[model samples]
Target: MAEIVLDKVTKRYADGALAVSDVNIEIADGEFVILVGPSGCGKSTTLNMIAGLEDITGGELRIGGVRMNEKAPKDRDIAMVFQSYALYPHMTVRENMAFPLRLAKVDNATVTRKVEEAAAILDLKAHLDRKPANLSGGQRQRVAMGRAIVRSPKAFLMDEPLSNLDAKLRGQMRTSVSRLQKQLGTTTVYVTHDQTEAMTLGDRVVVLRGGLVQQIGAPQFLYDHPANLFVAGFIGAPAMNFLPATLENGSLSTPLGTVALTDRVRRAAEAADAPREVIMGVRPEHFEDASLVDAAALDRGASFDAQVEVLESMGAEKFAYFSVEGGEAHASDLADLAADAGSAGVPDTGSQVVTRLSAASAVAEGQPAKFWFDTDKVQLFDPASGANLTYSAD
Candidate 1:
């Protein structure tokens, strides 16, 4: 295992369009890092640059404390698992896994031992004789992973290896891949547009946008305290509910009602020199049906009644959607995020709120429902710069 570092790395096309710019990431030995962003956000370009498939426009690339900018892909000593299985249809699973070892002229016995070990780790021991044609999609992906494992390289690079599988299989493969990486203790860098994969698989996730690094941190950290409107909106499942608010006298005036900012939030906003008009963010999971919460718990938050536009029952929990009187919050960052998410054409006539409520709640579509959210969990962002205004000093 080895540490991989990108020091102020950049990639610019001949036409002068920057694919990646001033990117820097330090991946520790045996750590699993993921590069995630919307399509064309330069995540794949950054990965290819690390893999030595693309030339760096500037800066240095290092692996195991050695400069590797000029090294060829084969000389990088890293195993890459591509999105496509890239398996030889004619070769059986055992032969496919052993191919890398054979190319290195490893002795037959050693090759056999490595391939067998990898097959067992990937739970493919039963399908050693099966060709790629006879394997399930998940099994084929495991075969590709096994091929990489047999090489026993310094690090592993995977590019959307689970994108081709069905949703259920993708979830299953995520567990398998994470387990395999932990068992082998190999350094890994994964690239994917799927936030769920990025969240569940990596020790740290790198969020990118417009060829720039937006934020880098643990999944929960980024979710709880995003660096900007883009990161806040991009990292969550139902995404965050953004509402335009006016900050004055330690209180915020919003469509829901006036919210008295908590001391922590007030201090952060004051320290950041927050603007008078700010965007307030609340996650879906942070809200609950007001009637279901204890009175003591309700005292810590604010409640508002809204006409539920839609209610989705999700077994353990429920999602209630409502439309506030005010229209959607407007900003350049929001526009860019909408474009990146392929929802640029979707009309935003009103501010839409989605709240996660208890399954036992009595909320129903077209009925007036009371929703309460913790005031301390709210985040404030600068609309123009998209910077988090309520970021804690710590």
Candidate 2:
């Protein structure tokens, strides 16, 4: 396996419309790196550039320390697994996996041995004689993977390889893919728009938006300390709830009421030279039912009474949605987020907030419930630039 690096790489269409800006990423040998974003966010374009499927307009593309801008895709020594399982219906599983080896003019015995080994690894030995039409969606995907594995290329590029499967199968396949990558130790660059996939897989995640690189870090790092409003809104499930608040004298005047900032939060704000008008971001998991909080814990946070609009009890935990008095906070960077959250199927009035509460808490729908959120856990963002004013490297 070899490391792959994109140094200030850019891609502009023939029409001069920039599809990807000056972006840099380094994928170490045997590292699984993920490229993730909303649809049409230049993730695919970036992947294609690395795969030699698209031309690089600026900067350098290197694999194994060699510049590869002008190299044809076949010479890149990388295998790409696409979102669609592009399998040949006429070819059996074994034949499909052996096709690459045959094309390389390897001896028959070596081809057979390689195909058998790949089939064993993918657990497709039993279905070697079966055609693509006879296999399940997951199995077909594995066949595609087996085809790539037999090549034993220097690196692998997977473009949303599991998007076609059902949720349950996707979960199963995710485990399979991770384990397979670990076993092979091939450098991998996977592109996906799903945050769940981005969080679960990859040693490092590169978040992109509007053809620009947002933040690159471990999934939890991005979740805990997003660099900007877009990254904050895009990384987590249920998305981080955002509200407009005014900061003054180490305190915040929010829709939830006046909140006294903790020392850590205050320092972050001061270090950023935080503006009076800032956006407050709190993850759903950060909120708790006030009734369930201990006395010491309650003392450290602020409480507000909210009428639960919808309560979903998930057994171990509960999600409580409330409608705050003020409307949604809008940011140019979060324009897509607001649009997505406000889709027709999901009502996002900009007034709604989601809180995760302990399942034991006594909270019901359409009834007022006291909720508490940790003051130290709050993050402040500049509405104009979408920068996280209250960000701390720690």
Candidate 3:
């Protein structure tokens, strides 16, 4: 219902340890923004500062166009749902949901109406009389959400609200939360360490690292056009692949093969005014079966060939892992790759090159395989600075 803004927002502890720095973001009315990063990345700290639970050591926070630095949490007109599902165990669902309204001395009739409406919205009508002790973990989390929803606050701030649920339940709740946000049209700011949650739930995701924001955009935007190495590695299911390469005459020389640069990337590099010491990046899904690729469609130069090592079938598609002829030295820093695979557990086969092929494609492990990518699909970054070679034309 209201826009939120953070202007050069920063947070620091009494010990002088910085928690967040210079994070400036503008959340439009009714937009669901997610703050995401790894553990100890200051996401929760930033959320807490916005909720008025933590002091801002520098910068400013504004909600609905008013400076909120001196405002009490009660006056901020924001409702927060935390990870722990902070419900009063002694009270029934109805009582728990009605507590906030009661504190504001709302009349009993209005409280009953509001609680009934919230319970119905959350599908908790049948469990209103049940105590928290008797409810399942998912139900308890719904109760936490019901409490926040009943108030109809200016915005909803959620801090990993689904962390306590099982995987299946978490997936179900992800859809439920997203649907609820849209149905209510509430402005929301959600914080999580889970990349999938950030990718799926947010209108715009703010990727942060070490107290600084890496990038802010739609989920696919960050995945397709990362601003730096950290954003490149953090925003995808199977993160973008990075290979050391040297740039000469506008082409990147990789062990696998050379990838020709597009005019956009070339222009960006030229604008940066630096010699081309760069890293070449490609998404796992960007590679195609080399034989099937149309060379005529390419801009004079774009292609790579490698040998496959392992194959993984995910029902509708296959991921082929292999090694480029001389790519053994690049194997040491695959932590980013392993992390992106999540629970599948990336195998330790030596010197592997990986690409996701379509379900209809005929490629097998250990086969001599070739892959092709559009030149524009490739991303280039400064090896030393980790900054994207291509800044936006805007």
Candidate 4:
């Protein structure tokens, strides 16, 4: 295992279009790191640069404390698993897994031992004699992984290896891949466009956009305290609701009504020198049915009535959707977020909010319902700069 470091790395095309900016990331030995972003967001380009598949326009690339800016892919001692599987139909599972060892001119007995070990680790011991054509999608992916494992390279690079499988199969394979990586304890760098995979698979996630590093930290840290409007909107599942609000005298006035800022929030806003006009963000899970909250809890939050446009019963919980009277929040940063999330063409005349309520609550569709949101959980952002005003290094 080896540590990888990218110091002020940059990639620029002949047309002078920058694909990756001066991004710096230090991946520890045996750590699993994921590169995640929307389409054309330079994730794949960054991975390819590390794999020596693309040239670095500027800055240094180091692995195991050795400068590798000009080294060839074969000399980097890294194995890559692509999305296509790229297995040979004519070769059996054992033969495919042992091909790398044979290419290095290892003795026959050593090759058989290595292939058998990898097959056992991947739960493919029974299918060693079968060809790639006879295996399922998940099985084929494992075969590709086994081929990489037998090489015993210094690191593993996987690029959306499970995208071709069905949803259920992908989930199953996710568990398998995670277990295998932990057992082997190899340094890994995975690239994917799926936020779910990025959240569940890596020790740390790197969120990128427009060839720049947006945020880098644990998944829950980014979810709870995003650094900017784009990171806040991109990390959540249903996405956080953004509403235009006016801040005055430590209070926020919005369509939902006026909310008195908590002591913590007030201090943060004052420290950051927040503007008078700001954007307020609240997650879906943060809202609750007012009828279900305790009296003491109700005293700490603000409540409002809205007509429920749609309700979805998810067995464990319910999702209530409502539309507020005010028009959609207008800002260039919001527009960029919408475009990156594939919602640029969606027309919205008013703000829409989703609330996750307990299954015991009785919220009906097309009826007025009372929803309460905790004031302390709210996040405030500056409209002009898109910076989270309440953010702290801690």
Backbone steric clashes in candidate 4, count: 0
| Candidate 2 lDDT tens digits, 248-273 | 99899999989999998898889888
lDDT of 4: 0.90
lDDT of 1 by residue, 148-170 (tens): 99999999999999999999999
Ranking by lDDT: 1, 2, 4, 3
> Which pairs of residues collide in candidate 4?
none
- Tens digits of lDDT, candidate 4, 186-271: 99999988888988999988988888888898888888888988788878788899999889999999878999999988999999
Error of 2 at 220 (Å): 0.8
Give the runs in model 4 whose Cα sits over 4 Å from its true position: none
The C-alpha lDDT values of all candidates are: 0.92, 0.92, 0.83, 0.90
Cα miss at 289, model 2 (Å)?
0.5
- TM per candidate comes to 0.97, 0.97, 0.91, 0.97
**Candidate 3 residue pairs in backbone clash:** 322-352, 322-353
Candidate 1 colliding pairs, count? 0
Clashes of each: 0, 1, 2, 0
Q: What's the TM for model 2?
A: 0.97
Error (Å) of candidate 1 at residue 45 is 0.9
Question: Positional deviation of 149 in candidate 4, in angstroms?
Answer: 1.3
